[model samples]
Target: MSTTQNERLRGLLEPLVGAQGLDLEEIEVSQAGRRRVLRVVVDSDAGVDLDTVADVSRAISAKLDETDAMGEGEYVLEVGSPGADRPLTEHRHYVRATGRLAKLQLHEGGELVARILTVDDEGLDLEVPGVKGRKPTARRVGFGDIAKARVEVEFNRKNKQDELEQEEEEA
Candidate 1:
């Protein structure tokens, strides 16, 4: 699909996610087997839940049905999180990934796995997550050349904090 079409799809899906308190990580359209698959990747500060996914799926499916955005034939709709393997690519992506560990794939063929020390217009500061030898190699990767990057879903204590806050609210 054209870039414009892809962006349009993001625009269309954003509100649906926002209303349901989820971040629309990305909306991808690609072929799965002989059919088209519209993958709606979602997440939230509280972590996404099944009910949220079902609600999002129903809402987006309705919008797609109304607009016929997929065009011709039937397409499978899959609503999911970006999973632990996907990389963050944009500024908003970085914000969403605050306090997470990430693997950076440089275009020059190298990898840097670090905690997102910080993010700014200059670049991302990745604290090399290991011993003294690595020394938190926070090299400046231009906004370009980041081939593929993603946050790793390691068990973090803050996840418990988030859960507690959610429970407090629900109570």
Candidate 2:
């Protein structure tokens, strides 16, 4: 898509997504065989569920049908949330990933896989897990220092609520 069409799509959809309490994470137009695909990525602090995806898809489809913003093409619309391992590009993305493990690549040279302890405007407070049974350490990283970051999926990691429940059971 041309830059103008991309801008137009954003202009038309951002507000509509925001009205539904979601952030417009991405908009992409790609080709598959003879068909074009318009992929819309929407997200929220609370996360996006299938129902929410469906509703937002309906709204976007309706809006697109009503506008010449898409120019004149038969395109398939796919609306969904960012995947589990999506890059943490925005401050809000980091904030939403709190309490999750993330792999952060630093600009100065080095990478750290840590659990996000907290997030503020300045940067992130991370708990870097220790190796060889050593104690974990705390580290601060300014957003400027991070070259790239993505949340790591931990299949066996227990969350605070689970730990708390276990402790209560023991008590």
Candidate 3:
């Protein structure tokens, strides 16, 4: 039930996001008593900001008002970026994290923590963890075992941001 509502909400917001040159990354909808709170997460190659968020939120609210999309109930709208803790799923995410560290959780409960080397049809190639007094190991993670992965953002260094910058320059 909740999933369907959230999908419908995503369906309603996608056009608005497209019109504003943003990519719809995720959408979350929850109910508190009689009020519905809709959180829409959007992103782009360059990222998102407060003004864009405000613009998206207003667009969604207006569209909902015209269509009564929430079905006669008041809904609060929130629009946001994916944040620093963005998950790595799509090939592009791995591509973005090239040379940056990541932690991958395998479906079978195995863990791989290392820098992203590459991502392709063959799947991801990552530098694996090693024990004390030993050099780190590298591993090729077939797509099947990857349950979840996220970039380990290094705040002091500019590696993560550099990835985005490199992408933009290539573009």
Candidate 4:
């Protein structure tokens, strides 16, 4: 799809999605076989639930139906939340990823995988896990210093506070 079409669609759908208390993270149109797929990625500070996705999907579908935005063709509308593996491009993205481990590519050089501590307008504080059983260290990284960043998924991770709370409840 053309960039103009994507921008137009973004302009058309952003307000509708925002009205439902979600940020429209991305909008892309691509061809799949004989049909086109219009994927809309949305998110919120509280995260998105299936019910909210359904509601936003309905609203977007209705709005598109009223307008000839997608043109005279068969298109699929897929509205969903941003996945864990999505890049942290925007400040809000980094903010949403607070408390998660991120793999960052530094603009100057080098890569660092650290757990995000906090996010601000200028930069973020990260807790760099030490090597070889050493103590974890803290560091600050400015947004401009980061060339690319993605959240790292920990499948076997457990929170100490959560474990303690569970033990207390069990006792």
Highest TM-score against the true fold, candidate: 2
Q: Against the correct fold, how does model 3 do in TM-score?
A: 0.76
Give the deviation of candidate 1 from the true structure as CA RMSD.
7.3
54-111: candidate 4 lDDT, tens digit per residue: 9999999999999999999999999999997889999999999999999999999999
Of 1 and 4, the candidate ranking higher by lDDT = 4
**Per-residue lDDT over 1-171 for candidate 3, one digit per residue giving the tens place of the 0 to 100 score:** 377776787788898998999988888778878897877888876678889888887887789888866787787778898867689877766776777788889899977778778878768878765778788887888777889999876777655688899899999
Candidate 2 lDDT over residue span 1-171, tens digit each: 889889999999999999999999999999988788999999999999999999999999999999988668688999999999999999999999999999999999999999999999999999999999999999999999999999998899987799999999999
List candidate 1 segments past 4 Å from native.
2-5, 106-110, 132-148, 153-171
Clash tally, candidates in order: 3, 0, 0, 0
Evaluate all candidate structures by whole-model CA lDDT and list the values in order. Answer: 0.79, 0.96, 0.80, 0.95
- What TM-score fits each model? 0.67, 0.94, 0.76, 0.93
Whichever of 1 and 3 has more lDDT, that candidate is 3
Highest-lDDT candidate: 2
> What RMSD does each model have against the real structure?
7.3, 1.7, 6.4, 2.7
> Regarding TM-score, does 2 or 4 come out ahead?
2
Q: How accurate is candidate 1 locally (lDDT)?
A: 0.79
Candidate 1: count of backbone clashes, pairs at least 3 residues apart or interchain: 3
- In model 4, the Cα lDDT at residue 120 comes to 94
* Order of candidate numbers by lDDT, starting with the best: 2, 4, 3, 1
Worst 10 residues of 4 by lDDT: 153-162
